[model samples]
Target chain A: MAQNKVLLKDIANSLGVSTTLVSIVLNGKAKQYRIGEEIAQKVIDAAMTMNYSPNLIARNLRGGKTQLIGLIVTDISNPFYSAIARIVENRANELGYTVVFSSSDEELKNTKKLIEILLSKGVDGLIIVPCDGSEEIIRELHENNTPTVLIDRNFPNSDISFSCLNNYRATELATQHLIEEGFENIALIGYKTRMNHILDRIKGYEDSMKKAGFEKYIHVKKVNILNPQAEVHSALDTLIKKKNADAVIFLTNMLTVAGLYSLNEMNIKIPNDIAVVGFNRNDLFNLFYSPITFIKQPLEIIATQAVNTLIEKIKNSELEIKSMVFSEPQLIIGASSKKV
Target chain B: MAQNKVLLKDIANSLGVSTTLVSIVLNGKAKQYRIGEEIAQKVIDAAMTMNYSPNLIARNLRGGKTQLIGLIVTDISNPFYSAIARIVENRANELGYTVVFSSSDEELKNTKKLIEILLSKGVDGLIIVPCDGSEEIIRELHENNTPTVLIDRNFPNSDISFSCLNNYRATELATQHLIEEGFENIALIGYKTRMNHILDRIKGYEDSMKKAGFEKYIHVKKVNILNPQAEVHSALDTLIKKKNADAVIFLTNMLTVAGLYSLNEMNIKIPNDIAVVGFNRNDLFNLFYSPITFIKQPLEIIATQAVNTLIEKIKNSELEIKSMVFSEPQLIIGASSKKV
Candidate 1:
C-alpha cells in the first residue's frame, strides 16, 4: 500500500528545501519568513503535487482555533430541528467553519456528554438546543468563556445567549385563529416540561382561552423522549374522551404527528369533529387530505442569527453579548382549522 | 472570568507538583511514570478540585488519533439521512467516538472539500453517503488507507466498502405491489443521478415492468439539490400529461413530498386517479389521510453496520475489507397502493 500521507518533510525532501521552508510557503507565510520567491513557488508546487494538507489537529493545537463548530439538537430526524441544522451548517460553511453535529435525544446526560466531547475535540464554538438539567453545564461553559449559544431552548438561570421562536406569540396567534374559527372547548396537547419554550406555548394557549372567555382544558402529556408514540396516543385519548375537546392545539412537532395519528385511528374528521393547529410546519401538513393549520417558525433567521452570534463571540471574546433573539412565527391556515 | 479555564499547570501550582506529574496522575499513568501512590492521589485530588481537563487537541497531536469520525451525507435536513446520522452518532458515541457531520448537498465540489476538511482535522475514520464525481477522492482515501465506508450510495470504479439498502429488491417489490394492484402505465419519478443506488432502483422498476409485460416508462427528473420542489412539480406534470402514467413510484424520500404535492395540486386522488409508492419510510407516510405505501429500510441496522465497519477499520487498518452490505427493505402497504 502507498504511504498513508505525504507530509511537509516529504515535499521538502522532494524539493531539496527545509521542512520549515515548505511549511512556511504552503501556509502562505514565506514572505514573513524571508524565503526566496522561486523556492517558495517550488515548495508550493511540490506540496500540491504531493497532496500535503496541513494536519488540522496540530494546527489547532498551536493556534487554539479549530474553525469547527459543534451543534447539538434535541432531535435531528425531526423536520423542524433538521431545517435549523441545515441552515446553520450552510451559514457556518459560508463563514469558513465546519460543523460537528450530534443529537441529544432529549436526554440531559447525553447533552452533557456531547458538550464535553465537543470541547474535547476543540471546537471553536458551540450551538446547542439544550435539554433539561443542562443549566449547570451551560453555566460552566459560560464561565470558561467558551463561545456558546443556545438555540430553541434556554435555561432561566444561565443567561446564555439564545435564538428562539416567539413561542408565546406563535401559540397565541394559533389559538386565536382556532377561536376565530369558532372552536370552543379547545384543548392544548403538549409534553409536560419545565422548558421555557414549552411553558410559554402553554401560557399562550391559556391567555388566549381566558381572553376568549372559555375554560382552559389543558391535557399536558408526559412523553418519553425515547418512545413518545405511546404517550401521544393515550394523551389524545384522554383529551377527546375525558375532556371532550372540540379543538386541539399541538404544542410541538412530535405531538402533532401523534395527535394526527390518534385522530385518524379514532376516525375523527378534522375540523368537523375537532379542529386542529400544529406548532411547526411539516410537509405532511401540506400534503395531508385536510391540510393541517400550523405555525411556521422562521427557522432560517433563527439559524443564521445563532451562527452569526456564535461566530462573532468566537472571533472577539470581548464583544458585547447580544440580547436573546426571538423571531416571529407565521400561522398557515389550512382546512383543519376551518370553522365548524 | 474565573481564570477562563483550569489547566494542569494550575492544578500543579496549587498542589506544589509538576504539571507532568499532574498529567500523569490524571491520565492514570502514575504507576508507569513511577510516581508515589500518595503523591499520585494528591495530584488527582488537586486536579479534581481545580477542575483540570486535558487539552484534547494537544493530546491528539501527541497520540495521533482524535477519536472523531466525520459523517458526510447528501442532506442532513432530510429525515431519511437524519435518521441514519442519528444512529451513526449513537453507535459511534457508544464506542467512544464523536461524529462530525456535513451535508454535501449533492455537489461534487462540496463533497470533495468536506472529505479534505475531515482529513485535515485528523478524524480517525469517515462515513460518507457518496455523491457523484467522488470516486477519485474515495480512491485516494482507499490508497491512503484512510478508513472510510460509503453509505447509501457507491461508485462503480472504487472498491470502497459501503452499507446500503437493497435498492433493487426494494424497488422491485414496490413496483410488483403496484403491478399486482392492476396498475398499468406505471411511471418512476426520480432524480436523475449516476449513483449506483439510484441506478439500481431504476433498473428494479424496469425489470418489474418487463416481467409484467408492461412497456417501461420512466421520468427521471433533474432535481435541484438546493430547491427541488419546483422541479418535482414540473416532472410530475410531464409524467401525467406526456407519459399518461397511471401509477408513480417515487425513488427517494424528498421526491415523494414533491410528487404528493404535485398530485394534490393537480387534484389527483390517491389509488383512485393515480396510485403511488414511495421509497424510504417517512412519518408523514403514516400520518397522511391516505397513508402512503413506502419501502422502509432498516435504518438502525444500516447505521450500526456502517459504524461498526468503520470503527473496525479504524482500529485495525490491516483488517480484511468487508464486502458491501445490503440490508433488505420492507414494503409497507397502505391506502395509496390499493387497487382501484
Candidate 2:
C-alpha cells in the first residue's frame, strides 16, 4: 500500500541481476552465487528500507517447498520440553525456516493424527518429541525418508535419526547428589513409562545406588503421575509406608515439582525431612519457595545441535548417520538437597 | 494394515449412500442433509469400532475449509496465559477444528509478523492475544474480511470482534477481597505498557479504593517484569519505601509470580508484613509455597464463546456487529491474603 516499496523485481532491475539473485541477497545466501559482498549488501539494505517482503505464496508455489519446519512436542506445559521447543524454533528460524508448533497431550491417537497433519502442512523437516512408542509411525516416517531430528526424550529403536540428552548421566548425577546428602534409602517415584528417557533415568539411579553398595535398598515404583500432586502423594505414602525412603528422586520435572508441593502440604520439610532431585531443569526451580536441586538439561545446546543435524540431513539428502547428540548436563545443588 | 479398517467408502457402500452422506453423518450434520438417524448411528458405531478416520486433506479441499484455527498467545511459560491458550485450543478442537499455536513473547514486532505468517498459512480463522493497539494492522485484517476473534485482551478503537473477561470488575473484586481482609494500604504493581487489561485493572482498583474510602492510601507503579530479577527486587524496594502498603494487587500472573518470589527473597511474610492478590489463575497459585488468592478467568466459557463467534463470522461471511462478549470472572480464595 505504500509507494516506493521495493519489489523483488525492482532489486533485480537495479542490480542488473535476476529475481533469484535478489532473493538470495535478501536471504543472506548470495555468497553461494559468488555475488560481491558490496552488491549484496546494497540490495539487502534497499529491500529493508522499502519494507519489502517476498510473497510467500508465489515463492512457495514456484519452489514447491514451504521451507517450514514442524515441531511436534508431546506436552507443551512441561517446561523442559517447552525449553527445547523454543530452542529448536530459534535455531531453525536462524537457518531460514519458519516453524509450526503442535503438542500431542500424551494421547496415542493424537500423536498419529498430528504426524499426518504436520506432513500435509508441508514442513521441510520435523523435530519430534514422539508421543508414546508408536513404532509403526516412526517406521512410516522413516520409510518416507523425511528429514527429522528427535530430541529431549524419544522412542527406543525408533531407527529414525535423533539427538537426545544423556538421561542416564543426568540421573546418575542426581542419585550421587542424594547419596552425598546422606540419604541411603532413596525412592524412585515415577511412572513406568515405555519411553526410553524414563527407563534410562531408572537405570542410572539403580547403577549409582549399586555402586555405592546399597543395591538391596534400591526401590522403584511404576505409578501414574497424570495428576502430579495426587499421584505423588499416593506414591510417597506407599514409599514411606513400605521402604521408609529418606529422600526422593523424580524421573521427570512434573513429578519433582508435584512431589515437592505434596511434601510441603504434608509438612515434610525439604532436605531436613526428605531430600529431592529431578532430571529436568526450569526457571522456577531455583526460585521456588525453597530452592530445588535438579540436573538441568542443556536445552539450547541440544536444540542447536538438533537443528544443525537436521539441516545437514536436508542438505546432504543421502547422509545416513543415526547420530545421538548429547549436550553436557549440569547439576544444580540447592538447599532442597544440601547436606546437613 | 488392519483388515477390518473401515473407510468412508465402506460406510457409504454399507448404507447405500454417497461418501458425503457418511461424512455428514460423522460430523453430526446429517439432519441438515435429510439423512436418517438410524443410518447415522450405524455408520458412527462401525467407524468407531474399526478406528476409521477421514482423510482430512481431501475433505478440506472439498469442503472449501481447512477446519483449523490459529491461536497466537504472548507467552506459554506463564501458566495463566497458557491456561487461556489451552482453553481456546480445546474449544476449537471440540468444534472439529485443530489449533495451530504460536507465541510472540510480548514483542510488538513479532505480533504483526505472526499475523502475516498465520494469514499466509491459510488458517480458516484466528483468535489473537494482541500485544499492542495495532488497530491499523487489525484494520488491514478486517478490511480483508478475515475470520478473526480477539480474546482475553484487544486493541484500542480497532473495531476487532473479541471477547474479554471483565478486567475492571475482576480487579475490583480482588481489591475488595484485600480490604475485607483488613489491608488498608494497597499497591498495584505490573507492567507499565498501555495494555487494555492493565488499564482496566488500574481503573477497577481506583474504583474499589474510592468506594471503600481508601483512595488516599492507594499506591501504584508500572514495572517491566521481563527485566532482570534484580530490577524486580529494586521495584519492590521502591514500592515498600514509597507506599508502605500492606499488600500489592498484581494485575497479571507474571507480575504475581515474580512479586511472590521477590517478596519471599526479601523475607517478607504473607498477610503479615504484606498481603497479595493476583489475576489469571494457575495451578501453582493455590498450591504455591504460599497460597495466593487469584481472579480466575472462565477459560472454557471464553474459549467456547470465541470459537462460536469466529465460526459465526466464517459461516455468515459478513459479520454485522463488533461482538465484545464478556464472561464473568471468579475469585479463588487462598491462604495468602487471609487474616492471620
Candidate 3:
C-alpha cells in the first residue's frame, strides 16, 4: 500500500514527461515554466486521478517557506497563554498558515532548544513568550532576519517587536480596587523573575500600595516551573499566617490556582478572611466558590496584532520593526474581592 | 549579519578541505566514511571556530526524519485536551521527540487539512483525537504506514491503535453515582454526534437509567464549535423547562461550562434546584461555589501510553498494533451531586 502511493515520478512516467515538468504543472507553475496549456491540463488531470498530493517537506525545501508558524509559550496549560494560542491559531489558519506550539516551561535552556528545533523545522515565522536568559538568542534571531515577534513578555534591551498586556496598569487597577474595597495591609504574591511581565506586575502593586500610604507586604516566590505547587503553598503560608495580609493579589494565573488551593486547604473564607485579586481571567475564576476578581487581558487584540505583525515581517524582511504594542486590561469585580 | 552566518562551505574554504569531508566530520560520520583522524579533527575544529550550525532543512532532506510528532485534538483551549497535550509533549520530549500540536475544532475538513500539513512537514508519527468524518482518512493513513495512534476518542471500525477512556464505563459509573445519591428524573446532556465515544456515553446513560427503572431524559445538543456558548445556553433552557429534569449530567468539559453558566444565569441552587455531574475534572470543579461532581480520566496514563505506543510503532513498523487500551475513570463526589 505504501509503494502504491503516487509520486511525481509516477505522473511523469505515465505521461511520458520529465518529473520536473510534472512537478511544475502540478504546482501551478505551468505558465511561468512555458508549458503548453494542453500539456499542463493533461498533467493536472493525471495527477488528480492519481491522488497526487505534493510533499510539503520537499516543497518547503525548494521554496524555503513552510507556511508553518512556531509559537513558544511559558505554559500551554495556563488559561492566559492557551487563550492567546487559540486566537493565534485561528488567525494564522485564516492566513493559510498552520501553527506548531511548544511550551518552554519558563526555562531559558528549554526556550533556546525549542527555538533551534523550530528553526530546524523551517517555520516561516515565530511568536514567542520569551523566558529570562533568552535575550541573546532572540537578538540573534532578529539579526538573522528570522521574522520573530515576542508576546506576553519581552527583553527591555532587545529591539524585537512584541504584543503584551499593560501589566503595570492591570496590577495597579487590581490593587486600587482592593484599596477601594477598604482592605488594608494588602499583600502581593507573584513569581520571582526578571521577565518584563512579572517585574511590571510587581511595580504596579508597589506603586498602588505607595499611593494608598499602606505598608507594602510583598511575597515574591521563586517559580520552580517543574514544581510550582510547593512554591505557591509556601508563599500562601507566609502571606496568610506571618504577614496577616487582609487582601492578596496574585500575579499570574498559575499563582492564583496555588493561592486558591492553599486557601481551600486552610478553610479560609473569601472576602471576609482575605480579599483576592488575580491577574488573568479564566473560567475557573468565574466558577470558584466565591468567584475571584481578575484582570482580563485583551487576548484577541494581542493575538491578532502579533500574528499580523509577524506576517508583515515575513512578507517584507526589510520592513522596519515596530515597537511593542500594549493592550489594556479590564478589572472584573467578583465576590472574592468584594468588601464584606 | 544574516549573510555572514557561517556554513559548512565557509568552514571548508577556510580550512582548505573538501565540503563533503567537512560535512562528514561535522555530522560525526568521519569514522563511517573512513576519513583520516587528523583531517576529521581539523574539520571539526574549523567548524566549531566558525560557529557553524547545520541547517536542519538540508539535514532533514538528506535524513528524511524530523523527529517531530503531530498531535491533533478537538480543541486546545479546552482544559481536558490542553492537559493531554501538555502531558503528551512532556512524554514525547522524554523520548527525544518534539510535539507539534493542532486543534481540529471538531471539523472534518480542518482535521483532514491538518493531517495533510503534518504529513507534508514529514512528522514521524501522529497522535489524534479524530473528528466524526475522519474514518476514511485515518484508514488511508494506516495503509500508508504513517505511525498513528488515536487518543481520547476513536473510530471503532478502523484498525488504528487508540488510547481512550472507557466511555461506557465512565458514563455508567457517573450515572450510578447520581442514582446512589437518590436523584430521580436525571437528564443527560451531551453533544449530538454519532462518534463512538459519544454513542458509548449515551448508551451508558441509557443502560443506567433503564436498570434504575427511571425514564431516560437525554438531551443531545447540537455542538456549535464556532459558537458553543449560545448552543449550551439554549440546551440548558430546554432541558430544565421542557424536560423538567431534577438532575443533569454534562457529557463534556465545555458543555459543563455552559451548563454551569446557564445555572448561574437562572440563579438555580446546585443540588437543591438541579443536581449536576460533569464528565471531566478541572480546577473549576474543585473551586465552584458548590463544587460539582465529575469523572476524572487518567490523563497521564492515557498520554504516556499513546506516546509510547506510537514511538514503538515508529521504531519497529513490524510490531503488531495493539488493541485499544481503555483506562478507568474515577467519579469524584462533590456538593453539586449531593442528595436532597
Candidate 4:
C-alpha cells in the first residue's frame, strides 16, 4: 500500500478494495453502497497507520481554494465576540478548514489592514463583523471573487454577502419587555454613535417607544467605558434627577457593565430602584448577584450559518444575493427586569 | 516606487532622500527621533503617490523575525484572559510586532498544535497561558531555540521564563482581610483541583489561617465551573447545615461569578451576611452593584514584558535562563469585604 503519499489507488490495493471504494472510503462521500462499519474502520485505520498524507494543499489549489476561512470580529476581548469566534473555529475545524481570527477593534483602518492581511495569507472565505466606513472594502472583496459573510451587523447599499440578526427587532423586543415590566420612562444607554449595530439598536428602541406611544419619556445617554464608572454615574444621575427614566435598556455589553457599576455606586437597587436589560448576553450576566435580563444572540447558530453559507459560496461562485439575514435572538427574562 | 514590490531604496531615490529617512517615514518608526514632522510627512506622502509596496513577509524575515507573536490563551470568553490578550496584542504592536492568537481551551493537544502551527508560521516568540500538562511541548520549544514566556500559570522544573501574580500571598492577604473584617470562620470556594494556581492559592489560604491560629474552623470547597452555582450552593448549604462557616472567599473570577449567583439564589448578602473576595477582575464584578474586591493583574505591563522578553531570547539565541518571575498583583478592597 502506498502509505507515504496518500493516493486514491493505494486504498484500492489495500483490503482488495477498488480505487473508487478507496476514494469513497477516504472522503466518506458514499453511503449508498452501505459499506459495513468494520470495513470502513479498517480502511481508516490502515490509511492512518500507513501514514498516507493527502495532498490537501494541492487539492485546494486545484479547487481554487486554500480551505482556510478568515473571521473578523470587532473587539476580540469582548466575551460575546470571543464566544462567536470559538463556535466558528470549532465548526470550521470539523469541516477541515483552518480559521484565522482578526480583530478590527472598532476602527476602519484596522479593519482594512486585517482584510489585506487575511488576503495575503490566502484565505478562501471571510466572516466579518464589519466596521463603519468599510462598505467599499466589502464591495471590493466581492468584486475580487472572495466568498464573504458578514455576521452580527448590517451594512446597506454595498451589495456584499452577509448573515446578520434583526438588530432593530431585537432592540424593540428588549424595549417592549421593559415596557411590559412597568418601566414607563425608559432611558437608553450606549457608546457614542458610529457602529451600525449600536445605531440599529438605538433606532429599534426609539421606534418601539414611538409605537408604544411613550415618546416624551425617551431619554438617551453616552458613557465612555475607559474611565470606568464616571460617565455611567453622571448619566444615571442625570436620568434620575431629571425624572427621565424609570427604567433603562443598555444597547451594548459595555453600557450594561458600566451602567450597573454606576447604579451600584449610587446604591441603587435593580428592579427595586430601576429596571435593566441588554442586547448581548454576558456569561456572567446570569451569574451577577442581581442577574440582569439579556437577549441571547443565537451565537452558535449564527456562527454555524455564517460558516455554512460562506463555504457554499466558496464551492459555487455563482450563488445569488451578496447577502442574507438570519433570525433574531430571544429575549431572556432574568431578575433585573422582574420588577420589584 | 513600486507598490507590489516596493523597496526603501527605490522610494528614497524617487524622493531624493536618504534610505534611513525613507525607512523611518514609511515604517512610522521615527516618532521619537524628532525627524522633522514635515519632512517625515512629505516622505510618506511621496511613497503614497508612487504606490511603494512594503514586502511585510520579507522585511519580517530579514529582521530576524516574522513581526508576529503567538498568544495562546485558555479561554477568550473569560474577561480576565481576554483582557490580557488585548493588552499583549497592543503592546506587541507598539513593539513592532503583530499577534496571531490561538486558544487552547484547556486542552493539551490543541496547545501543542497551536505552538507547532505558530512556529511553522515563523513567529518570533510566544506568550502562553499554558494548560496543566504542556511541559514536554514547551521543552521542545526550548530545545529548538524558540523564546517563550508562561503567563497566568506556572510550569514546574523548567528553564522557561514566566509571569504570574504571587497568588498565595494575594489569597493569604485576602483571607486575613476576611478575618480582619470580623468573620472568623471563612470558607474558600475555588475551581476544580489539579491546577498549579488552585494549589498555590489553597496553600496560601491554609497557611495564613494556620498562622492566625484558626485552623479548626476553616472550610475549603472545590467546584466544577460548568455548573458552578448549583454545586457551590449545595456546598454552602451543606457547610451551613453542618455549622461550618460564616464567610466565603472565591479564589478566581470564574468562581466569583458563579459563587455570587449561588449566594444570591440562597438570599445571602455580601459582608453584612457573608463577607467575600475573589482573584482577578470581571466587568460584572464591579457592576454587581456591590464592591467586589479583586487582585488586578498588570496585564499591559505583563504582556509587554512577556513579548519583549520572548523577542530578546529569540534574537539572542545564546541567552540563558533558569527561570524569570514577575511581581505579585495588588489586592484591592471593596464593599464585599467591608468590616462586618
| Model 3 error, position A176 (Å) | 3.2
The C-alpha TM-scores of every prediction are 0.88, 0.84, 0.87, 0.80
Docking class of 4: incorrect
In model 1, which residue pairs have backbone atoms overlapping below 3 Å?
A: none
Clashing pairs in model 2, backbone N/Cα/C closer than 3 A? none
lDDT of 1 at A311: 95
Q: What is the interface RMSD, in angstroms, for predicted model 4? A: 7.1
Which ranges in model 4 have alpha carbons more than 4 Å from their true place?
Answer: A1-69, A121-125, A220-235, A267-269, A287-290, A313-321, A338-340, B1-48, B57-65, B116-124, B225-230, B321-323
Tell me the tens digit of each residue's lDDT in model 3 across A1-340: 1435478998999999999999888778999989999989999999888888766677777865788899999888776787888899889988978788889988889998898878777889899999887888888889888999999887776689999999999989998988888887788877666788888988888888888888455544455555677877777778888888888888888888888988888888887899889867778887777888998888899999999999988888787777689999999889999888
All predictions: root-mean-square deviation over Cα?
3.9, 6.0, 3.9, 7.3
Candidate 1: regions farther than 4 A off: A1-53, A215-226, A319-322, B1-53, B215-228
How does residue B225 of candidate 2 score in lDDT? 38
Candidates' chain A TM-scores: 0.86, 0.85, 0.87, 0.81
Candidate 4 structure quality by residue, lDDT tens digits, A1-340: 0113456577668778887676667778557677778888888888887766454334343444556677888877778887887788777866766666767876789988888776655568889998767878777787777788888876765566667777777888999998887788999887774657778888888988998999988887766534536777888989887875778888777678778777877878887788889668875677665678997778888888888888888878776645476577789999988867
lDDT accuracy of residue A90 in candidate 3: 88
**Compared to the true structure, candidate 4 yields what TM-score?**
0.80
Rank list by TM-score: 1, 3, 2, 4
* lDDT, model 4: 0.75
Instruction: TM-score for candidate 1, please give it.
Output: 0.88
